[model samples]
Target chain A: MRVGELSRRTGVPVPTIKYYVREGLLPPGELTSPNQASYTDTHERRLRLIRALLDVGGLKVAAIAEVLRAVDDPGRPVHKVLGAATERLGARHAEHDDQEAAEAGAAVGELIERRGWRTDKSSPAAADLARALAAMGRLGHGAFREVLDDYAEAAERVARADLGYVDRKVAVEDLVETTVIGTVLGEAVFNAMRRLAHVDASARLFGTRPEASD
Target chain B: MRVGELSRRTGVPVPTIKYYVREGLLPPGELTSPNQASYTDTHERRLRLIRALLDVGGLKVAAIAEVLRAVDDPGRPVHKVLGAATERLGARHAEHDDQEAAEAGAAVGELIERRGWRTDKSSPAAADLARALAAMGRLGHGAFREVLDDYAEAAERVARADLGYVDRKVAVEDLVETTVIGTVLGEAVFNAMRRLAHVDASARLFGTRPEASD
Candidate 1:
């Protein structure tokens, strides 16, 4: 297939596809002549994955490039690929050294230790957790830490389900992309459900309909 | 305190504070002279709230304005204020009427009915769920919906805990802002914890250290 057909099939404009190619997010098609290039089924598949990451995962182009690099690297372990993909999901912030952040980091370290988790304290996810806690403390919600255990329990259950789903895949080549999708899009799925549940719970508590206006 | 003092107190720059005033995200300090204005403790608190929404909650200026309007409206119910705040969390996409989106919408509607949730189908959160499911279908991960029940269970548990925390607050004035903080920062906290749990689970399954590089 040619770029035009690829664009038509994917509903992505030709110029955007060219931009993706230029940005190294998508590979260029094979040149059949001076002015014509051919794309393969693999290209179509890659394009769809690219679109999913951009639209649903909300990953930046450079981040997508990094994750795709890990996905395409056959020698990388599946867990490593998964880590690469999940790392991009966190916001990039300069690590804070304030007292609240320090205390929050200590709390995070304790939580990891208590759970017997093997993750490093310096990981971006850990930093994000600490940062969130620090922010909560600043907002006078430091007691929010009391619910951390419940959140952890729920997180563990969801993670187990996620891994179980991923474990059923038979192909090594398919594992990386599948993990990426499950991690990224799965977050979206869970978040939306959480909001729905919140509405349900709030309605029950307040004796109000969910559609009530402000 | 003057604008510069407000800036010094909040760590927000003078110009940024003025910008927020201009954007109506922050109310202007009272004019005391031709060139001087005085802000109050209320200004300091509101400034902090604004920073929390922008930094930790990842809310846009306009969304913050809507939420603040609800917060300032004493006539608004707490749940309504919450709805206003959470409405900004989901992406605002033009609604899709395609087959996959339609099917996903039906699935969302069914899920709501089965769970006895009172939310309208047109709610932003519901629309977000449908959009996510449609994107999953496009990516060949429609089976992700199989875990919807488990996700819902967890969401309910979290939501219950959240409302319980808010219910403990004694001041009616605190309810709306607290709910907003819990909803937004709580999402961040849960997401980070989920990623941490994923790291733990993946490590145990693969016998790899979480800190291992790709």
Candidate 2:
């Protein structure tokens, strides 16, 4: 398949695909001619995985590339790849003084400890936020650690509550991933849902909520 | 107050503050000379607000400018400004043409509805996702709606459970915002908690459970 076909198949665009190719994030398609090339099923699958790492997993291209490299390398431990990706998924800030950033990161860790959260130091989120803070530093921002703390406190409460639902139905890895994804992605998903909820709730109770945001 | 003073107070860098001034996100201070200018309390406050919007709200400078303009213009209804922000947040992905994008956004909206979440559509997060999606589109990637749907379903269950903790203690506004911030920010926090959970649960008689990909 050509770039256009891949685009059609994946719903991605040619220009963006080219950019990905240029970034070395995606393998170049087989050269069929000067202006045309062909892709394969692997390309499609790779593209899907890339999208998942990016859009769903919310990873940067550079980070996604690293993860893919690790996963594709059979010599690398799968748990290490999974561990790295999980760490990347957490709230990350890249711009902070090392002292403050580390302290702030530790603050959240300590809070979790105090709360009796049963987790490990190798958690993906702690790494994710730690990486994010390091990245935010280059962009000339450093308030992310404190901001993350504020965000974390509220999340702690929610996570504690959500555990009650497992009722032994989920496996540990499944439970952990879903819990992490839910806390992180859930905020985005639920906020959207909350908007919809408002509409229905208001319509049912008051006969109207504004049709949309004013 | 000098730039240094403002920097000390807000914890934002002097250069970034200058960047904000150059970008017209912040008004220029009283010019003392070619190399010097003095700020005031107003500047400090504005800087604080700017930091909050960026760090806590996760807004880009350009979008933050628009938000600040709306926030400052008393003639405009707060609701309108908020609505615009929410709309912007909801439309974060502008460039990707993935068929799954729209469905994911809609699914997120629906999941919140099913979970009985109540939030104002005018919240900053509404536009945050929209802007993110727009940037994502430019990258030639797509976030599938089903992935988000699966995420939302899992999140709803977690949120529903989390809600039980704060149901009686917090106001609706606080509950919703806390939940939103928690879900978003806490994803990382809880990952840390769950990393600990994984170790704890693994020690139990159940052993490791299934992974929840779908």
User: Isolated chain A: TM-score per model?
Assistant: 0.94, 0.52
Please give me the DockQ of candidate 2 compared with the native complex. Answer: 0.19
Off by over 4 Å in 1: A94-96, A212-214, B94-96, B212-214
The residue-level lDDT of candidate 1 at A30 comes to: 96
**Candidate 1 lDDT score at position A3:** 95
Per-residue lDDT for B60-131 in model 1, tens only?
788888878877878766667678767767776534467778888888998989888878778888888888
Per-residue alpha-carbon lDDT of model 2 for A102-199, expressed as tens digits?
Answer: 75567556655665444554455545544334333322334434344333443443333334434334454344333333333444444554333323
Q: Write down the worst ten-residue block by lDDT for model 1 chain B.
A: B88-97
Please give the distance, in angstroms, between residue A110's alpha carbon in candidate 1 and its true position after superposition.
1.8
Runs in model 2 lying further than 4 Å from the true structure: A30-37, A51-59, A75-78, A89-107, A121-124, A127-211, B8-13, B31-36, B48-58, B75-82, B94-214
Residue A88, candidate 2: C-alpha displacement in angstroms: 3.3
DockQ for each candidate? 0.65, 0.19
